[model samples]
Target: MMKFRHLRYFVAVAEELNFTHAAERLNMAQPPLSQQTKQMEDDLGTILIERGSRPMRLTRAGGAMLEHATRIW
Candidate 1:
């Protein structure tokens, strides 16, 4: 089961594309935000964020998730 908190975290990170910025926006710390994002990806069984990129990039699955998440809110 997918949690809304995870979805919200994903949406935040997806929109900002920066862990620090997303964390700031969420009023949390970067490490935990990054961890949650990774956990979410793991739980979903897909790589949502491309960690190798400088600013970070979203996988196709992440993009689709963002699209759906935006519509949800």
Candidate 2:
């Protein structure tokens, strides 16, 4: 089962594409934001964001999940 908190974290980061900015928007620290994203990926058994890349992009699964998540919220 996935947590709503994880989903919120993911959506914020996915939209911002920057942990620092996402963290600011989420009103949380960057480390925990990263951790929640990792937890979400671990729960789904797949990679989501491509960290440390210029113009970050989401994996295919991540894109799909974001779509569903958007509809969910």
Candidate 3:
């Protein structure tokens, strides 16, 4: 079950492009933030952030999600 917080967490991570920074911005710990973001991916059945990359990069889907998430936020 996807929730609004999933989008909010993802948006923070996407905007910062860094999990640590995004977690800090969101006033939460990194592990939980990472977990929620991963859960969001699972719920959507699509990769949003390229976790394997250094500094991270948003996938095409991620960019589109960010656009919508930002508007909603």
Candidate 4:
């Protein structure tokens, strides 16, 4: 079962595309937020985020998850 918190975190990261800002927006530390995102990616067995890009790039799956999660709440 997936946690709604995880989805919320995911969407935040997706929208902000930067962990630092996203973490600030979520009122949490950046490391945990990034860890949560990484955990989500691990759980889904797919790479959600593409590194080495400014503002971070969302993979196709990442975009899809963002859209879906956004609709969840």
Least accurate stretch of 10 residues (summed lDDT) in model 1? 1-10
Candidate 4 per-residue lDDT over residues 3-65, each given as its tens digit: 889899998888898999999999999999989989889889998899678859999999899
Clashing pairs in 2: none
Error of 2 at 12 (Å): 0.5
lDDT of 2 by residue, 12-68 (tens): 989998899999998999998998899899989999999868888888888998999
Candidates in order, TM-scores: namely 0.92, 0.94, 0.96, 0.93
Question: Model 1 compared with the native: what TM-score?
Answer: 0.92
| Model 1 lDDT at residue 2 | 72
Task: Provide the global lDDT of candidate 1 against the true structure.
Answer: 0.90
Kindly list the per-residue Cα lDDT of model 1 for residues 1-73, writing each as its tens digit.
Answer: 6788888999999999998999999999999988888888888899998999986899999999999998886
CA-lDDT, candidates in order:
0.90, 0.89, 0.95, 0.89
- Deviation from native of the Cα of residue 40 in model 3, angstroms: 0.4
After TM-score superposition, the amount by which residue 30's alpha carbon in candidate 2 deviates from its true location, in angstroms, is 0.3
The local lDDT score (0 to 100) that residue 38 gets in candidate 3 is 93
Q: How close is each model in CA RMSD to the real structure?
A: 1.0, 0.9, 0.7, 1.0
Candidate 1 segments whose C-alpha is farther than 4 A from its true place: none
Best by lDDT: 3
Top-TM-score candidate index: 3
Each model's total of backbone clashes: 0, 0, 0, 0
